[model samples]
Target chain A: MDCVLGIDGGGTKTVCIVMNAEKEILGRGETGASNYQSIGINAAFKSIELAIENAVIEALKTIKSLEVQVICLGLAGVNRPRDIEVIKKIVNDLQKSHRLPIMWELEQIIQPDNKSNNIIICHDALIALVGGICRDVGIVVAAGTGAIAYGRNHQGISKRVGGWGYILGDEGSAYQIAIAGMKAAIQAYDGRGELTSLVDVFTNHLQLETIEDLIEFVYRRGMGVKDIAAFATLVDSAAVDGDGVANEIIDDALGELVKATFTVIDAIFCPHIPNPSPQTIRNDDFEIVTTGSVWKGKSNIRERFIKVINQKYPYIKVILPRFEPAYGAGLLALKQYLQKSDSKAAH
Target chain B: MDCVLGIDGGGTKTVCIVMNAEKEILGRGETGASNYQSIGINAAFKSIELAIENAVIEALKTIKSLEVQVICLGLAGVNRPRDIEVIKKIVNDLQKSHRLPIMWELEQIIQPDNKSNNIIICHDALIALVGGICRDVGIVVAAGTGAIAYGRNHQGISKRVGGWGYILGDEGSAYQIAIAGMKAAIQAYDGRGELTSLVDVFTNHLQLETIEDLIEFVYRRGMGVKDIAAFATLVDSAAVDGDGVANEIIDDALGELVKATFTVIDAIFCPHIPNPSPQTIRNDDFEIVTTGSVWKGKSNIRERFIKVINQKYPYIKVILPRFEPAYGAGLLALKQYLQKSDSKAAH
Candidate 1:
């Protein structure tokens, strides 16, 4: 049996999986952020190496004489063309040290390609979308550090919207919502704006006396968007307590999310999402997939997102991805290895 | 000669003047905040009495006034009708104590009042505007603890904008701009947003290691807006030295100031600047009066304000009010006294 490795690198941690040609899970390992820009190339290389080595060693312990063939990775910060080369070099260097028949490849697996090519270099969001829909036609919104909405149709055409970073866009992303909440809380504390418990909660969370104290934790100290996003929970609590300001902020965030989803939906319908059936959407058949930490964590935001969509497009069915993005990557790697072996034999 | 009195009550300190009916300065005295809400009514009364007594004694020591015929007071926190009654009673009691023919009257003067009637209770901003223009027709913006703008035309009509206290409005006010700078500095420090040296300067000012330390001084400790506003100077210094984020904040604040002034400008031109003459604008026809500690303080904000205004309303001249709002209160008191005397004679 051939050992295949799949990796999912995130902002804080990386998850790795090792399996064989029989599709039996062998081993799993976890490491820290392997994103080049965040941990630096040196640290990223070390982390990725450690993660793969641990997973491979564990798999070998269980399945002796396993021949490794394919190594697939879906990294957090490797979205650009330049990142591909860097990742390739890292993998090649690791291969030199280990001396195994490991082929480095990106996990760009789109569900549409599942019918033929099977595997490709893609984002975890795409994986999550595929896991949710298990089909080619759908949309996925990944809300985490920042928010992005991506959509595809039966024809395999994909489009994106509202993925702007925290500074510009990101609309309904956790970070965006947290920033808004922080702004509101500060205004309330200073008597410059409306009042809310959000300030109290935020200040207490930061262990300060005033909402102004959070300015350090939020702006000066360089808190993560995820950390800021954590404040959304406080906002939700306040909204439940009947804080008009907090409620307004949540509503505003929901509005932004709806707008983002609508953008993808419009793309799926018009220039982006093609209409397979001219007669009816029921016959047209489409699905909306959700991805990232935001969807998996809080129910309030998730419910709000659904409520917004239901109010707008009641016909659309929203689906939660069945598997983690890393699993999607693993499936892609397995299929790819199988295709290669079959083609080689045919030739 | 009949002694006339002028009183200027403020958030921090109070000033009182005993002058002759001829409008000649006699003697002055100083005390503390006369706001009953901030300082209890008892303390306010004691401060007012002590201040007046000192001024009267000083005046008598020199001129030995035949009698204090009329006394005028421009007090702070006397905006409410009930507050006016409380102040009136205080003065009436003081007048009785003297056992002299002193006609006592109360004037509600805070700031941001247009030229209309005497003894108009206004925000301190209006007083500062009068400090600059000393005219009946002009506009004034106070940019100290909080920013507020007030303007009046020849017909006694006044307009105010961006005076929504320290939170919602007060756009380019010192406190607002200072908070902006502080937030930028903190954002840079945290890694959540752009980086700037504002954190360094702020920490240095507060004698702290990180921006987090300063947060308590501003929020938990309940520091005055002036203390927070003081940091704006540091932002300016940093910006001058080429801090990108600091520069961006300064520019953004300047933009807000421009928007605020335009509100006043728009109000002025609402009726077309009342072009009675065929000529464009007469030098004496229109003027902008500025007051308040923020505007008078030596900051780059003033120059930017002038630059922005000139860019839009070039033909209009900006001037300083000849009398402080407290002095205006004095004038108002004198006017009322004369009207009473005239009515008595007619009767």
Candidate 2:
């Protein structure tokens, strides 16, 4: 029985899954953060190996001879050429030792940029698509510690709507929400803005007496990005209470997210390619697949994203993915393997 | 012979001058910071006494038995009514010992608010006028750690134009300038803003590769406000070399000062305060007395303030203050005594 291994590595944790030839997830495991640049290469690679081992061990309990397989990993920091080469060598050595015909697929391989690894022009959003709705066409508005929106058309055309980092962009992202919350706190402290209990909560969290002191800490001190991101929950709580500043910040973020979604749709579904021009293919409408931590449950963000998207493109349908991103990677690998076999048969 | 004592007590040092009723400065002495809030009551009083003793000794050498009568002091941090009352008693006791009347003027009394201490009432700017032209109805733009512009019209009806403090106001203030400079350095480090040599100067001064560490020191470690204020000189030097960020901040401050001057003139001069306004009573075209360390020289700020004022109100003349703010305190106190005596004579 043919099998494929897929791994999704993130900043905080890594998720690995073993799958059969039919794209059925047989086993899974999780490990620590794999951001090599941040946490060092040795630690990151070791964690990846451990997660794969655990997943393989788990799969062995259900299926016999699980060692025979193809491996694929959707890693967070495999964008650079050096990182890709290092990960490739490690995966090749592991496959050789296991005595399996395993193929390592860097996330960038599917991402269009790596011409050598371009088996399919796919993205994390595409994996998100598989996770959100288990469908080809849908939209996934992901809002966790950060925020980004991804959508895939029925034609298997995937597009990234948002997900700009903490600073310049990332509308409706957790980081943006936290920044908004902090700004509100500052305004209230300075009397230039309204007062809120959110400020108190934030101050308490930071162990500061005044909002001014908190600002000084955040601005001057090199506070962690994640720590800053975590403040979004405080903002969300404050917004629920009727703090105008908190509400305004959330609303602003929502507006930006809506704008970002529309921008993505325009880029993919609009008549123009680069921009409005004479030679362009304008489609009537397209479905969008949505998935992620933010859209998983009952949050204001989910409803807002839906409402905003519907307001602009009422005809468009946003579907939720059925599987996780790791499983999606395995499925893509299976599809690629099948397509390659079929092409060989045709020859 | 009637004599007057003028004292300018600051944070670092105190200056005292003994003058005859004829407006002749007979003797001057310097001591420590007599701002009671900065130095304890005992130290502040002792400094004041020492300053006075030294000045008196000098005066005695020239004019023996110079019956020193009235004493006026311009003090820092003597703002509270209770504090003023306490300080008033202390000064009165000192005066009584010398058989003289004591007058106290708290600089903060002229401030608009706690945050707006840099902004002074029109009357307070008169001190800059006193030091500059030794006359009423002149303008004084003082820029030291902060910036304030004060001017008055004849008829003893003085008006203050600018002096808003370091944060919200205080255009052309050293603290503001320095902060602007520091921000530029930070932006350069972060790569979000334009590159400037201020980064090197600031980093070298603080002995750090980046401001990240220093920022924590300033905010988290409770660095001194004066030290923060010192960054302005660094900003000035950088801006002089055409550092984009520094230049922008400096230029912005200069613009603000110019606008503040116009605001004072508009409200205190022609339109609002009746046809024959304070400026008209001053007998000349509106005279703006520039005072303070920032406005003392032919710096860009001085030229800018004058240029902006002249561009709008062609008839308005710019005047530099002859004396410091402490001297203005003496001017106010002496004026009060002169008024009382004149009233007595009239009766």
Q: Where does model 1 exceed 4 Å of error? A: A21-24, A99-120, A131-137, A190-192, A269-280, A284-286, A296-299, A311-315, B1-347
Q: Write down the TM-score of model 1's second chain.
A: 0.81
Candidate 2: residue A99 lDDT (0-100): 34
lDDT at B109, model 1: 23
Q: Candidate 1 versus the native: TM-score? A: 0.51
Instruction: Tell me the tens digit of each residue's lDDT in model 1 across A1-347.
Output: 56667777777887777767765668777889887766788888888778777777677675666555666677753555566778777765776765442443433323454422332456655655654675546787887767777777777777666554553356677776676677677545443457778877777777885554453455345666677777667776777788888778767766766776776665556543444333345555687777756565333767878877866567778878866665656665776788777877998
RMSD of 1: 15.8
After superposing candidate 2 on the true structure, give the runs of residues whose Cα lies further than 4 Å from its correct spot.
Answer: A67-69, A96-123, A152-158, A204-207, A216-223, A272-299, B1-347
lDDT at A11, model 2: 86
What would the per-residue lDDT of candidate 1 be over residues B215-236, giving only the tens digit for each residue?
A: 4456445677667777677777
Mind listing the fnat for each candidate?
0.00, 0.00
Docking outcome class, model 1 = incorrect
Give lDDT: candidate 2, residue A37.
60
Local lDDT at B231 for model 2: 68
